[model samples]
Target: MGKSHVLVIPFPAQGHVIPMMELSQRLIEQGVKVTFVNTEVIHNKIVTSNWINKDGVDDDLRHMVSIPDGLDPCEDRNDIVKLAKSISQNMPGKFEELIESVDKEDDTKITCIIADFNMAWAIRVAKKKGIKPAAFWSASVITLASVLSVEKLIDDGIINEKGMVLKDEMIRLSDSMLPMKPTNMFWVCFEDPALSEVAFQIVLAAKQASELTEWVLCNSTTELEAATFSMYPQLSPIGPLLASNRLADQTGHFWKEDTTCLAWLDQQPACSVIYIAFGSFTLFNQNQFEELAFGLELSNKPFLWVVRPGMTKETATIFPDGYMERIGSRGKIVSWAPQQKVLAHPSVACFVSHCGWNSTLEGVTNGLPFLCWPYFSDQFQDETYICDIWKTGLGLNKDERGIITREEIKSKIEVLFNNGMFRANALDIKEKVASSIAKGGCSHSNFNKFFEWIHEKDS
Candidate 1:
């Protein structure tokens, strides 16, 4: 057999790329030759972003190849709806051509494709090119069960073809899984036409993956989602594909990490810090930003916050007068922090997060209790799992203004630390997460099985 060469593609978002990137590095560690592919814009951002640390990986391994996303240079790829549309409409042909060129030039021919589920068209394209295709569902498997059930949902009149929930209710994906708010079906669950288009696109992609693929690679563990895994036997859970477990801290981030946070964390007493980060894409309005700042101040807790560029909506100012000075050395804020380092820090006790799956798993991986403030898409679902089913997190409720107030934030912190109940729960879940990734653990065994599938005889 020729070398096991795989073409890896992600959906071009920080969240999507990081897990796929982790998977790529893991494959490389297992002696698979990998061609890592990303959209041209995302690749440039990773190269230019201040948060990346590139010295750790080999130059050959670090080499990234890009394909056009079919958007004008001036287009804002940050706009999720337009970006999703562009990727769906554009990347398949470009990727197909890249594969052909690679097959001719490289000694090892392309044997398979491991693509992010959002880019389902790549699987269809792989079929045409006669390459094996596997889809990576980047979010929780419970979320996948919800997405893969789209057709059943439509048949039951629960959701429309456009991905809209026809009735306002909770959606129970499986008997053992936590039920979800119908409105939080996904990012596309919104009634807005633009968001609806993206939702439908996701549904279509899910359909393609369920119908066309033989094995679905998920970034979750069977222990974490046992019921979901049992419900869909085709999904092989090989994750919490955390950088820590894989021995790679270079999971792709679009911003430079502030190493200073580590030094800052080292000074604080054990479990005394509250680390706050609202992932890459969540933007805040001026009022909401000020409210959060005041909320953090009111809590009077030692905190490390990531306030990225363009995070606030044309607010002209993100913090109120004297806020930073009031907190003084008690709080640390940067555009980005090496998250895994901070989460793993002994001083970091509670997490104020956007409930993105990566952040959720990071919290789980590090055993940090959560204060869930979800931002968009499937975040609500992950939060539900954390706070509702898993009981490792506390969801912060928005006020009458439909905002998370300073008082609300302050109160939640006090409540979370009250007798340290949530921390105890988090530690229990942490044991499961650790065991899932340890040698001969569930994820380790599942990953070995996945590699076997990759090396299986097609005939």
Candidate 2:
């Protein structure tokens, strides 16, 4: 007779938090009492960013809570290995305590726990508390399949127990997925051996935790990866979880977005502006930054680029000499952007992106072609999906020096523009994604089933 209560937790990264927050909003709309949890540092950023507007008196069923990530305020939260280790060690006990406190303060009891697959320890804690557990994979289903295939990789001797690649070869998990080099495995992609080992252990833990989950939800669609979904029937495709789908402003940004960019986009000619943005955590050396700048200049096309703080290794992002004067009015650069709106704008042409899953989905849903410049980890795999599988994008080739030259950037932009097929493919994928979330579509059916399951009295 009481409203079902759910506790939602996401890995404390921008990409992970946004999708999980969107899912929480969906649950709220369904009349569920939801508690959304974030790390203390991330929560502070969200609050200061003013996206949530907690002061507005509206939804009493929804709440946002934060727990310490076990790091001091001055610590570098950007270091993935350190942050991962700290959360694994410190957050579990803190999360359990939060649950106990919430029960004492609220009338509804938490009936289920939905956690990011990366933070599978929450699933363990949920089980220990006799709460139903579900795992949400924010990235592509192919990536999830890869993470769950750690044991098979070890059995095949492709990787060692510590997640080191023993053999340098291309392998495919199934005929449905793309062939990838052994070295590119998510855990093995780290440059540091110690970091790779820790990442591997985390992956192993997630896979083990998955076995205990009652439901496995993925922010993907069978339309995009039908073959992979067929291979792993457990993954339910309920995503492209964007706020735009529900006609709401996106939340969970670590940086405040610049709305002026939207006005600048409106002034540009239709399909004339190049939109470039790398997701949070991408860093560039001074050389690459300069080259990217000159490349955008050489393209001679109107462009909007997001140069987030700390994007470059140098203390400050330095443009080429007289760069601002030379490209006056032709270029617009902002520290952070309203990406979903930018992608949806008619003036935007194509995306020059780092190929993070969130950016990939945004571009795909908006029917924009891509010029892929993947940096590391799962991004490389995402590029393969964009360029090879979907044929909606082209990859930028780095020179022998491992820097993408200005000429290469200019050339790829020209190629992407000249080719109509890429846009056609992009539009085609966009239509499929639209249909998937529409009534009677696969994602719609899956979401309805999930909703029913969550409301089940026995669950």
* lDDT of each candidate versus the true structure: 0.82, 0.90
**Candidate that would win on TM-score:** 2
Clashes of each: 5, 0
Question: Where does model 2 exceed 4 Å of error?
Answer: 54-58
Q: lDDT tens digits, residues 83-192, model 2?
A: 99999999999999999998998889999899999999999999999999999999888788888888898899998888888989989999767788877777888878
lDDT of 2: 0.90
**Top candidate, metric lDDT:** 2
In model 1, what lDDT does residue 38 have? 84
Instruction: Please report, as a residue range, the 10-residue window in candidate 2 with the lowest summed lDDT.
Output: 50-59
Backbone clash pairs for candidate 1 read 50-256, 51-255, 51-256, 51-257, 295-406
- lDDT, candidate 1, at 448: 86
> Model 2: what TM-score?
0.98
